[model samples]
Target: AQSVAQPEDQVNVAEGNPLTVKCTYSVSGNPYLFWYVQYPNRGLQFLLKYITGDNLVKGSYGFEAEFNKSQTSFHLKKPSALVSDSALYFCAVGGFKTIFGAGTRLFVKA
Candidate 1:
């Protein structure tokens, strides 16, 4: 069985601080991990992905993720937080079917 888990329901950070949204996955074979952001009442937007090659993969809006084969984790990271960056994030793993995380809400405080 393949699945994705977003350990945190919400993440809070100061406007200028770095932010991370944790994600872990379980799958049978080589996994394709992806990060998507969703604004309020909007569809999910592709942020970044880790299909193959390179442990660290960069994505939109200064976002990046490191695929850890040992840990089976693909954690999303941002160097600095922004108020406009506040949104809901989802972690998905591709297998026979795509499994999406519960979705984490990010809050950037000024």
Candidate 2:
């Protein structure tokens, strides 16, 4: 069985600061990791994925994540945060039946 854990319930950042949302996973075999963002009252939107290759993967909205195999962690990052970037983020791991972590809400203030 595979499971995803996001330790943070919410992340607060200044408007232009870099932001990160942590995620870790445990699985039987190699895991496929993904990040999705959900705006208020909206559906989950695919942000990025790490299927294979390059430890660092880039995705929509200037977001990127590092896939650390040894640590079993995939942490999402942004060079600079925006007020518009504030949203609920989810980290998921798996193939057919993906397991998603409890969402982390991002609050970016100007």
Evaluate model 1: give its lDDT.
Answer: 0.95
Off by over 4 Å in 1: none
Tens digits of per-residue lDDT, candidate 1, 4-110, equal 99999999999999999999999988999999999999999999999899999999999999999999999999999999999999999994467899999999999
Q: What is the C-alpha lDDT of each candidate?
A: 0.95, 0.96
What's the lDDT for candidate 2?
0.96
By summed lDDT, which 10 consecutive residues of candidate 2 come out lowest? 94-103
Query: After superposing candidate 2, which stretches have Cα over 4 Å from the reference?
Result: none
Please tell me which predicted candidate would have the highest TM-score against the true structure: 2
- Per-residue lDDT of model 2, residues 1-110, tens digit only: 89999999999999889999999999888789999999999999999999999999999999999999999999999999999999999999987888999989999999
